[model samples]
Target chain A: MPTSLAPVSIDELKAIAKRIRAHIVEMVYEAQSGHPGGSLSAVELGVALYWNHLRVDPANPDDPDRDRFILSKGHATPFYYAVLAERGYFSTELLKGFRKLGSPLQGHPSMKALPGVEMSGGSLGQGLSFAIGHALAGRLEGREFRCWVMLGDGELNEGQVWEAAMAVPHFGLGERVIALVDRNGIQNDGFADQIMRTNPPAMFAGFGWKVIECDGHDMAAVDAALAEAERPDERPRVVVAHTVKGKGVSFMENNPGFHGKAPTREQVELALTEIAEGLA
Target chain B: MTQAASAAATREAYPYALIELVEQGVDVVAIDADLSVSTMGYQFGEKYPERWYTVGVAEQNMVGIAAGLAACGKTAFIASFAVFLPGRCFDQLRTSVAQPRGGLNVKCVASHGGITVGEDGMSAQAIEDLALATSLVPFDVVVPADFESAKQAIVAVGKTTRPAYVRTGRPKVPAVYGPDYRFELGKATVLRTGTDVTLVACGVMVRAALEAAELLAGEGVSARVLDMATVKPVDRESVIAAARETGAVVTAEEHQTTGGLGTAVARVLAETVPVPMSFVGVDRYGTSGKWDELLTYFDLTPARVAAAAREAISRKR
Candidate 1:
């Protein structure tokens, strides 16, 4: 599993998040096909989990007892790939090959294609159930490994999500499972609220889950919410991190146009410059 | 033909085998999306509560959870009516289970396969389940003819690491094989051999085919019988050899004529030896009735198989 707690400071995490944002921009720009808006929206959430909370080891990716992170909102592959690469699961150079043939970095996260990926997910609302499988198996095996899954707020439109939401607490798996929702408020067609208004906090709480809402772009708040998730409780925890559609880049922030579109070369340069300014 | 004087439901045999696997120390977990009584999966749950999960009436969630369990190193056996599995959760099965290369060790053994589900009506009968399951890559699809083969097939799939889909029926079928019969994943068992024509069948139709061979024998036509228990990764060599030797082939199943055993056999024959062929299966949706009544209603009887076999033989060049 993990060797020890994250040794990096808050400043280091911010720096890492900035670099991750840069990688996401460049990866989508090169692949010319990926979901960059959701990718950017989930950068800080990815950083907080990979750097501060999850008990995963890059070297021993297949360790049975390691904590698992499933991207339920799997369209955010650029974000997931950047996080895995930043965590030393694979080389950052491979980021250039995202969405290409023979590249381990598929447009969607595939478990067999990459070592760090815990589940193959592109179809939304299914990852949480898959995460539940890991948690149920851990309990059966008498292992203490925890499972973390990230879900998109708009992806809640799928009824299967509610099915899993109802199952986690029913199984008494609250102690070993945690879910993070990226409430970016923007789906592909339009704003999430305008498309399908599923109040995640109320919905999850009604399903008997412990809900934690935070500013997803704020690294410290994301870290704090994750820390709270680690506290012992009788209900499974959900950190509803409020995020922007295309965070970091000023032109794309809260813009649904960039949801699944790649940034042009000029847009990439501008996005990188904006990200570097955030680093400062 | 040897009548064993005993019969059992394939659905009943499935859970019996699951209990055996657990007793034999196979680390398997069973999941059902309600209908446990019909699928007979509740027996496994009642026996081993720790290793069983019933995910309400949600088939999609059940499939995803099963894939997850298998991915985490448990031989997860998810059960439901055949109509609910591939019928309601094809996307989950595709992305979560089958799309993964070398598939997860998940065994989807759905009961109530084909029109043999009987009184439940057309909605419950899964005529195209074999087509949906066999369409996936690296999935071992098997349809056991009788209780003994169903028992052995479940245990056989549990022992292997590959993903598989085994379709079983709700009705008590006549015994086609005894305790000495071994169930292999991709091998066809030749129940009887002859040179005039071949009768290939699966599930309850295997019994019908055997009876049909006897009828053909009475008419002075030497007919061969092959029990095609495994539909996907189908025994191509056996099918080709039968076609090459007999020059006529008639496939029988308690399923749709469009897909199921007929389409699988046609693919092999069309690629290898082109032979005169006919299919004796349900060509339309079925209605609510008794199991035997539906069999006659769909023309899935021994007489139908005999007539189809003769039709194929008459067309042989």
Candidate 2:
């Protein structure tokens, strides 16, 4: 029998991503709520960024010089909270309390409720601007930390996204910032193409960014693209990571109906079993 | 002769102060919504090519972009017509900048604040910018009266840790404070004082309220004049004393009564000790006219403020 099947190479890191996914499933099943499709799709991206890139000290979150990250498409916090938990920013047990009353982890990220969360965002097309502010602040202090923003492909339909796109190059912050697009074409209503079509990499290129494409499910590919982003360059990089809406599990893969729906107990058991077999 | 002399002597100084900041390696980022010349952001951009960022005509993006730079710990100064920054970018500012505990020190150098923005007409004038910004969390509002104060306000914005809006205007109004004057966020400055009535005003109306106070003094009415520059963390103590001691309050501004200085003063008086208060501001839309004519149309004149104060005092008994 094969020893492992998860895309991440480091066993410890792979286990961390798995545990995050398990928590995501556990919380969604417990709350009888939360979006799993996009959450599942972005698990790798969030894990990759936080584990390897984002210079966060779960110990001193208020450290002003820490690298800034904004989840522009903020609904996928289930995926992010899991990473934050495993990375020790908060208790891993807090995952089960997701969406409960007074839980620091809310249905949407809130700046006031939680520590280390940079901003309260469930809105789209706005975080990039905040990221810009963080980057600008970093420059002011001559700080070395980079600012990263994760956006969904569906939010590309928002005209405000292009507004940020046009200004990124003009500010000469090409090397200081990185924007990643979770290119999972399904949004809330329907398929991105059937709803609104945008070639993000090409669009970003037109806006004068250095664009890179990678298989989001492949950890090595994602890691490589991110590493390349840190190189001394004059253009802000955009990684167009082609990801599946519901990755890993069988029934939910590429299914639009699961956009914001959580799995039931029976379905959760089935998913766990399926994921276990994939692990084997 | 006094009124005529004040009008000719007053000068517009926001752009020059911004240039001074740029010269100080302040890294000031100025943006305009395609109306750079009108907003005066274009002037700063021209002088400081490296620091200036004309983010084209997108007002929402302009604010969003400024917020992004602020997040990165940059001192971003965004300039636009009052109509667009607060009017069009309420969502960006609310969610992105003000909601976050530490939104980058992005200052909204909003020009055409209140009804003083002429000709571009009522649509361009941002009569609600102060109220909208002050109502949000973690935001400090400043309405400077003259050129030197505007310069000091911009420098102060850099040192303060919260998001700020330094409201200025198109017309060159009289300078109530001279060149060496200092200002702070959330602190009220007493311009002139009297026992009959307290005249509280901000922005362009500060000078008008001062004029009105002088006029009231001529009519045997003692008026306490205050420059309530910072509207958000409004100085409740000073405002309360003005209401208690003077027994009447008249708030003059180039804005609407709903969220402007009038409502703010009324709120303070109601909680402290209920007293008679009247607001002198634009209660209706303004026509496209010269800047002076528009200010007069809105009844934002010292003469009109004196009348409002007299009327409020009469109703006090």
Candidate 3:
């Protein structure tokens, strides 16, 4: 039902990656508002996750048996929105109304407004604890759905994040939890290393998580790393994805200034050109 | 006090009552920040091992994790010293539990409030806890005066769909109600009636207020003693009627005067009918000493309440 990408070669994955990136840029350009930068950086990670790993139902979003995906760092929600739309969770035309008045998209993912969002997460560092709650509930109730949370490396500075990190492994909430750290080393202020340098992998590994490193821009590498996370064990796995701040566009790449900025009309045209050409 | 048939003090009866919610097809979980035994969540944890979590001496995480569990349809109770759960987890409780939809039924049972913690000094005594917990987003703050009221508070907190905090005292006090006595959330019971003065009190202090009312009668001041059990969503109509009938008022609680019964009573009186008022409570923290010595240190005895009532009557003129 997922188009069976496992036996399909790297070239097929790249083609699907291009289609997903096209969906991302076009959705952002049509809306004329959204954080295209963070969305672009997480393209490959999104393709790797949604297309492969997560067991979900586009028809039944609230199915308790389905795996839960929590986006703690919510700025990149446009990418998730695009993926959800393209996957037939909703109509593709709804993507044009993102961040508009009375739209379900409230700039940040709200579980109250959106169907697929597991928890409200505009404020960082709180979702992981909530994920642990769901994971623990599933474990206690003997449900089979696993929990996945995609976190921003910048959000690691918040104290509650570490409290959650310390807690997840301490509970030994197995394959039940797979944390994806989008380590682009960027935050709202500036480069995270300059602002507050976080040692994410080592810290999570020290806390009894099985660690995996991968190039986030490479879809194949991301899928491989996420696969390694499925093995049931005592350790909760952290897949630290080394990514650029704005991965796709040549001008916006590695620029922290693009963190929350939507593209100007002229800028949108140029971004669409660059993304379309890169895909081609 | 008991000769033959002994009943487990209401504090001892709490966890046993809590386990029933789990059997009723609700996920009742407990989080104790290293005070499980004192808080009575220790027995609950022992009875339901999979449902209990010892938050390892951290009250903040205990609150946050409770919020998390409540988010996922589990009713979690944070059992701890009144000072830490409300004081340490104040912000998390406000942002997480109070703001959530259908109101996160995250219950908090604080074992000790006021100088009744005793012997642990000012650090462990949660004199101002009731006041602080009442200020949260429309929270139900229940200060159960006696044993039956204490058990009802725990069960009522689980049944009510709001953020509720029930503060229970440490020492084994006399039972206030019978085995099947029902308790309402915001309604106050008129323990005794008189015309000259109205004394409002809750928690372990209500017994003292009732005693003080008897003493006030001897001094030619007939006082109406009311149990203002639920602090927030306070029994305002009864408080206003008391103020209307009795020209003077004295509010007593095992909490600071800032946001407890005194402040709530004063607000209602100010808006409806202004009455002369005095408050009897812990103005400062306690030092490590015997329970009576600590209550004495805070001036929370019945004599102090009677004095405050007399003073309030004198101020009414």
**What is the alpha-carbon interface RMSD for each candidate?**
1.0, 2.4, 2.5
Estimate, for each residue in B117-214, the C-alpha lDDT of model 3 and write its tens digit. Answer: 77887898887787778888758888888777777767877876677888887776666556666778889988899999999998878878988988
What is candidate 2's lDDT per residue for A1-280, written digit by digit as tens?
1111233454545556676677777778888888888888887777777777677787877677777777888888788788777878888788878889978888878764665677678878877766665665566567777778889999888777888777777767776678999999899998999988889988999888989899887777787788787676777899899999978777778899888888988989988876656541
Among all windows of ten consecutive residues in candidate 3 chain B, which has the lowest summed lDDT?
A: B1-10
Model 1 / residue A102 / CA error / Å: 2.0
C-alpha RMSD (angstroms) for model 1:
1.5
Ranking 1 against 2 by TM-score, winner = 1
**B264, model 1: CA deviation in Å?**
1.2
- Per residue, candidate 3 scores C-alpha lDDT tens digits across A66-160 of 78788878778788887777666888777777778878876777664566766665767766776777777778778788788888899888777
User: How many Å off is the CA of A27 in candidate 3?
Assistant: 9.1
Of 1 and 2, which scores higher on DockQ?
Answer: 1
Q: Candidate 3, clashing residue pairs?
A: none
Better of 1 and 3 by TM-score: 1
lDDT for residue B87 in candidate 3, whole number 0-100: 87
* Predicted structure 1: lDDT: 0.90
List the candidate numbers ranked by TM-score, top first.
1, 2, 3
**B174-284 in candidate 2: lDDT tens per residue?**
556655567876778898979989999988888888888889999999999998877777889889999889999988887787786778778888887788888887777
Candidate 2: Cα lDDT at B101: 55
